[model samples]
Target: MSELDAAVAAALSADGHLADLLPGYAPRPEQQEMAAAVADVINQEETLVVEAGTGTGKTLAYLLPALLAGRRTIISTGTRTLQDQLFHRDLPLARQAVNRPVRTALLKGRGNYLCLYRMERTLESGRLENRALADGLQQVRAWSGRTRSGDLAEAPAAASEPALVPRITSTADNCLGQECPLYSECFLMEARRRAQEAEVVVINHHLLMADWALREGGFGEVLPQADVYILDEAHQLPETAARFFGLSVSSRQLFDLARDIRLEQQREAGDAPGLSEQAARLERATADLRLVLGDGMRTAWRTLERPVGEAAEALAHALAEGIAALAPQAPRGKGLESCHRRANSLYQDLQRFLAEPDEGGQVGWVETRGQGFYLRLTPLDVSEQMAGQRARHGRAWVLTSATLAVDGQFGHFLERLGLDDARTLALDSPFDYPNHALLYLPASLPEPSHPDFAEAYLQEAQTVLEASRGRAFLLFTSHRALQTAADWLARRGHHQLLVQGAAPQQQLLDRFREAGDAVLLGTQSFWEGVDVRGPALSCVMIDRLPFGSPADPVLQARMEWMREQGRNPFATYQLPEAVIGLRQGVGRLIRDASDRGVLMLGDVRLVQRGYGRQFLHSLPPMPLTRDPAQVRAFFADQSSTSS
Candidate 1:
């Protein structure tokens, strides 16, 4: 037997703290093979893309190999939830089970650490909110005295309040950096130092991308080299990558920095000129931008240059004058210096866009989404950046998700990752779909584009929700449709409503579980990584096929780029993206083999449109039915049997 295989066998036979690793925790044949395959990849220094299906013990499969690889490994997860689980629960147990002497560390983004400098500034200034801010500061003061790691999660009631949280938090823009009084004891710097020496470092995707974006230099930088990198919950990478590579500077940031400066100066007895005037300048810039945007119902994105119309030009000039006035008066310290640098950089960026419009990159504006405004510039496609960086780093990169494959191939993913020489792998889920889930497509609904679409979709949803006895998640492709269905369901008043945005997502989920026979109305965020096992989630209702909005700036540019290359954007780009999104939505239904549920898609285009078959083929091969009664019958059978 190979050395890696022998090591795993020894660990499997050990007695340890891991509850899942006891004698009762026998691995299924497929799980064993997956674990062995993961080991082989690490030992041979080969890139792998293994899709360990849910319940295939993928976490253990990779964690064991990572420990056995006997090298510095960096494990990055797509979400904070999974990162916490791995560091707190999985990794500790895996270490004991394997009985290794490996040293490890958990490193989250800088925002997670208590910014002692900022906290002190807020406390001394006394410009913070009210009694709640006082109480929060008191907690931070007490916790800071005893805490070693400096991670904010150590504080009780930290995550509950965002307002109180931000008052004590520090950002790269406002950090004191090397000149700060607390530089020697800086939490962020300490975390990075620990990460560099530790054998294994745990981080999230955003931090990983931030490291890539900033490279190894600049404020709050990450450690440089790693032997292996494993990313869990890989499905969220595409959108996350898009967001990190995109650029947008908000007016709120300027306002916050000004507020911080005014407060800090008042406490420190230091005279900083132009603080009030700078704040006003930023406020005026915001107002000018708003006036240009107006309250128009329709919004359009213009190329950075190309005369943003006359009104946009006026606003752009106003912003330029205001920023220039404030740039000279910024604080002289390194922290404020960084802020100044960024401000000057943004000013130059705006000038370039205004003067040279087609500046050979992606630049667009999104609605400030509120009374505030936001103008942005982002790369058209991150594929080249991602692929080039990974290839240049010369590390084995593995991208795995249950939904990565489109039509039994990885071309879409390969193209996006810009990987020509990387290896690929795919694995099927172990669940028996024929018995566990049913793909129910309604025959009576009109086309999605029809005027009667919302009502027709809601009617089918009502039937399915009734059949499942309100143990259903009614997902909508658009927020408008979600609100419409929510209003209709509220009027009907048949089941308890646990809608999104009414409460925190986890709280809403908790209430949904508590109220077993209830309906949940959520949009895009609910489509993935939402686990409601057992009978709590017996049906999933998708209002329409998930597709990227054609008018979206980034997606539109990518589509145009693909078309220019003699490629069919719909077939090459849109279809695969939609398929992956659909799979994520549908996969939320059947989490475990014993957990049975019905999936209802209200969009009739799945049958009418030729591309619909491509989407359907990506889903689990479940028994398909167009009859609504048959869906009702399956639930009835489950109810009867349960009773």
Candidate 2:
């Protein structure tokens, strides 16, 4: 082994320093093997794609190697929640265990930091319409003076007073950059400077993908190029990448532009009546466009109703009028000049959507959510763009997650990111899954296509809930199914039911743990990145095979693109994606060495369909049973042993 490889192995060994530092430490050969692989790639300056299963202590397995190699590294995670956990909890613990004094910095999107110039401008405008908003702004103003990092996450605004977030934070469209009077004291700039100097930087996939698409002028401020990149939760990277590698116009962007113009008019263009009137007209036009787009619609541009096309034309006219009025006010002040530039950019973006769909893999589509609508010109596939990112940055790369492989194969993931030549590794969890868990598939449920499928699944799940008591997670493939199940359970009033949209995710999770016997119903968001050990979460029920919605505009475009290439989309694309998703939802059970639980798949297709064998081959080695009596007996044995 090379020097760095040896160091990582020794640090994670049974008798190493990490043993004493970590409580309830359990040494597993799988973790050591994974760490050695990571270290070898870092030393060789190569790319490594790895999947380390649950209870493998993956955070430490990759973290120790990155620290020992002593290279400038960028550690990107799937979400801000993971970003904070890695930076605050994992990084500090690893540093103390290994005795390394590495310089570390945690960076997030620009919105997370407090912008001093924007806060001052908001105060000067005196636009607070309520006492709560004013009090929240005042709280941030007082906290800003003492905050060294100005993360806003660190500020005392009782969750940063979310209502004042837009008022206090700066966006790329409004920021004046080096021209601002407070350029030297800018929080975002200072954070970037620290990242440039630190040995290791923690960021999320959103910012990483944004930087890869550096020209859009979104949150695409390129981070300091690094010697190494370690992307944890790598399964989420492709979806995040798809979002950034597209061009779009949104109702949100149009409304925000109008609001900014009004603010700039109040400050610098007070004498220009035409400017403010045009801004008002732009907002009204945007509202009309959203109305015609209709709610719950996501389809290609050509398929939209005729009214939508007309509203887009009126919107274009209103936007042109806005640019005409703002052109004369461009010389008034920096803020006004920025607004003028933004109005022109927004107009150009909307023109792309209004025109015919462009060639070269570009798929024009529109989606309306609530009162907001988005028009996107997205590439059907981003493999070429993703390949370019790997070539541009990092001497060494490590992409890892719990669900990167399906049926012992990495072809689907590698082909998606154009990393076909990268070395791949899969490590099984050290926990004894065979003895600690059981897969309960009821033979009685109807097809997921049936109209009464939700009702049938819940009726069958009533017995499993009784066996495991009330601690269970009812995972659904669609929001409609989730609502149906929630309504049925709420009417029963048997257990403390917590629905996903009823509260914030973190709050719901916190309440679930404390309640110990509550049943939580959730959709896609609850499929992964959740951890609950012991009997508090003894059962997991999935209502259907988690497949990508055919209604998704992007997915539809991709399916069309695959057909043009003469490829079987279902076997190659959809099946693998669904397998990984099912694994993620099933992973919620049996988290620790002592943990025990049962997984109930509500869909009968797992056995009725031939492709079900592939999913079985991908999951852990847990005994499967179709009888409810076997499941009840397993839980009964556990309860008897505990008593």
Candidate 3:
């Protein structure tokens, strides 16, 4: 065996380096296999795609090999929580175990860091209206003095409110870069400097896409050239790439730009000629456009010409006039120059958004939610773009996730990512699923479209909650269904109920764990990345199949595009996406070997529909049943065994 292979094998052995370093470390065969695959990718300098199931210790499996091989690697995760965990917890442990003193750094998007310039300007300009916001700004000011990393996450007051963070952080369009007074100690620049020098740099998917595709101009070249790229939650990459590869313009963005121009004029040129009046005109025009679009209306671009054409054209003209009026302003300072540049950029973007045709593998749509209106031109598929990036980078790419494949095949994922020739691995969970879990597909439920379906599902859910003693996550695919279930359960009053919108997600999870017998009803956000091991969460009840709504403009356009290409949209796109979602939801249960629980899938369509077999085959190997009595008995057995 090669030296790299030998090191990986030794690190995964029962009496290996990790076993000696970590107390109570037990060797897992699946983890060992995954480690070997990762090592081979490093040695051969090739691409690899792996679906390492939950409890497979995949983090350490890849970390150890990267450390042993001594390669400059970039590790990207789906969420900030996991990125922090890998940088602060997992990497430290693995580095110590492998006895490698490698340099590591964690980099997040610009929004996470505090911009001293923006904070000072906002505070000095008296833009904060309320006393609470003023107090929060003072607290942030105090924290910023002592913060080394300047990450807003380290500041308690600023992190508490979502509205305050954006006000204090500098976005790409508004930032003055090195010309700012506080540029010498910029937090984002320092973070990037550290990343460029570190052997292992950790970042989230959005930042990774921005860096890989050069989406943001202000954050120039954040990712250094690396030998290996490891993506942990690799399933989220395709969707994220699609977003970064698209163009978007929002009414809010225009308002913000106009507001910044007014502030800059006030600060630099006291009462600039026609600037203030034009800025106000632009803001008013944007608001007028929003009013015309109305709320909760998502219109296709092709159909928008008649209803929204006049209002949109008016807004575009106002933006162009504003840009022309601001172009002749003298260069007062970097800040004012930035405002002029921003106005010009906004004018260009508005022109493109107004006239860009929805052709050549792209779909255009306009959506309004509450007070915000957005026009987006999204690519139908980003596979070719991603493939080009991969080829240009020519680095060893290692993509691994627990739910990447359906029915033990990576074809769907491979096709979406354009990785047809990449090496593949599927490692099953080491946890004993059949012995510790039960899959309950309740029988005799009306179709999901039926008017009485919600009532029927609740009746069945109540029985399962009674058996499991109210320790369950009632997951729904839609907010309407979630509200229906929450309302019915509130009326029933059998158990303490925690609804999704009642509190923040983290707070609700804390309450659920503390109550120990409460039922939590939530939607898509609660379906994955939740770990409530032991008896606190003993039942996970899914309301129905998580198929994306065909009414969604993006999904609808993609489906039509697939049909136009003579492809089966259901088999190629819809079913695989739902199957992956279902797998993620089910994996929330049985997090560890000793953990036991019951999985209740309320969708009768799993057995009634012809495509249900794929969903069944994709799930972990758990004992299946259709009887309520069987569920009760299984919980009883679990209780007795724990006692």
Candidate 4:
């Protein structure tokens, strides 16, 4: 091994500092091997896509190499939980072990921090619609004085009233930049700063992708250039990159712009009555568009009412009028100047969103989410834009995740990221899956397409939950199926049913843990990132293969492109995506070495379909069984062992 390789290997070895720093830490060959590989890739200045399974200790494996290499690095994670863990705990331990002075910073999305300007403006305006928001605002006010970092997660009030978040935080479009009175004291600016002070930066995928998007747009990068970039949970990047790379003009943005314009008028341009009038006009136009585009599933933009265009035009005109009004008052104060800049920028975005060619590489669609509507144009294929990012960033990239491979191949992920020539490695999980877990594929169930499928799937879930004493995750492919299961379970009322939408996610999880035997039913969001170990979560039943919706406009567009290239969409696209998704859902079952659980595969397609082997081969080495008696015996053995 080279000197750096040897150094990394030694750091993670049996008698190394890692053993001294980390309690219960011992020599693990997988970790050492991964660390050496990471060191090699960083030294070579190339891209490496790796899959280190759940128990492989991938974080330390990469961190040791990153720290020891002495490269300016940016590590991005998929979830805030992992980001916080890495920044607060794991990175510190690794730094201590390696004895490296790596200055690290954690950068979250905008909403995580309290915007001082917005907080003060909101407080002065006193625009609380309800008592809860009023109380939450006061709480944030109290916490802001004490919070050194200004992350809202530290404030209990923001935790209770999440709706108050957008009111107090600032997004890229609304942030006042260096002109804000509190710019020097801005918490988000400190968190999202560049490379001079910090050697290593930890951020979530959203921010990383947003930075890439900004660079691609020629607007400049949000993050500083680094020698190496490590993306943990990298499987989530493709979709996130796609969204950021697209054009978005939402009802929320328009409404917020209007609200901010009104606030600035009252504060900086009190004599300009036309500014307030234009702001009200923009607000009304936004509401009218949301009404015309009424709540349903995502609709193709072309299919919306012509009045939708009219309302959007009205909004653009109002923004134009606001910009004209602010241009005169712009010299009055920083607030007026900021409002003028924002109106001009948003107007350009709305025009582009409206005029984006439908026949090009982008697919235009609109969806109403809750009280807001979003007009978006997503790229049909992100591979080219992702390639553009690679060309521009030009750094050594390490993308590691538990779900990056399908049937032990990296073709799907590499294609998605346009990293075909990049080196790939798939590491076996360090857990004893055969001894600790079982994959039970039930016999004689209807295919996911059949009308009787939902009922049959629930019956199987019920059986598994009963055998495991009702501690399980009933994961479904669709919210409709999840709702159906919830209604069915509610009607039966036998087991303690914790439905997804019935409460907040953390509350549901806490309840599940406390109840000890509650079955948590959830859809796509619950399939990944949820880790419940021990006997509290013993069974995980999945309703069907998580295939991308054929009705999805983006999926359809991609499929059309694939067909034009003489490829089968199912064979090349749908199957691999579904396989990776299934791997993620199954991975939720076995979170730790001592954690044992039964994974109930409800979709009969596993045995009947030709592509079933893809998913089965991609999964960890859990013993598969077809017999219900065998499944019952497995759970029985677990119960007896625990007793």
Q: Is candidate 2 or candidate 4 better by lDDT?
A: 2
- For candidate 3, write residues 353-392 as lDDT tens digits: 6676467887788899778898888888988988877876
What's the lDDT for residue 44 in model 1? 70
**How much is 619 displaced in model 2, in angstroms?**
1.2
Question: What shift in Å separates residue 506 of candidate 4 from its native position after superposition?
Answer: 2.3
lDDT of 1 at 263: 55
Give the residue spans of candidate 3 off by over 4 A. Answer: 215-220
**How would you encode candidate 1's per-residue C-alpha lDDT over 504-569 as one tens digit per residue?**
788889998889898899998898778888898999989888888876767777777778789899
Candidate 2 per-residue lDDT over residues 1-643, each given as its tens digit: 7888878878987778888897867678888888898898988889999999998888888899999888999999998888999999999988877787999999998999999998998888888779888878888889889888989778864426655787888877778898898989999999999998999999999999878787345444558879999999999988888778888888877887898899888888789877879989999999999887778888888777788889999999999999998988999998889988988988998887677564578788888888889888887778888888898789899999999898999999999898966999999988888888899988888888888777778888888998998889989888888898888988888668999999889999999999999999988889999888878898999988888988777777788888989998999899999999999998888788888889998878888899999899999999999999999999998888778
Better of 1 and 4 by TM-score: 4
Error of 2 at 517 (Å): 0.7
In candidate 4, what are the lDDT values of residues 135-155, reduced to their tens digit?
889888888889888887778
TM-score of 2: 0.97
Task: List the candidate numbers ranked by lDDT, top first.
Answer: 2, 3, 4, 1
Highest-scoring model, lDDT? 2
Q: Could you give me the TM-score of model 4 versus the true structure?
A: 0.96
Candidate 2 global CA lDDT score: 0.87
Q: How well does candidate 1 match the true structure in TM-score terms? A: 0.91
Q: Which stretches of candidate 4 lie over 4 Å from their true place?
A: 159-162, 193-195
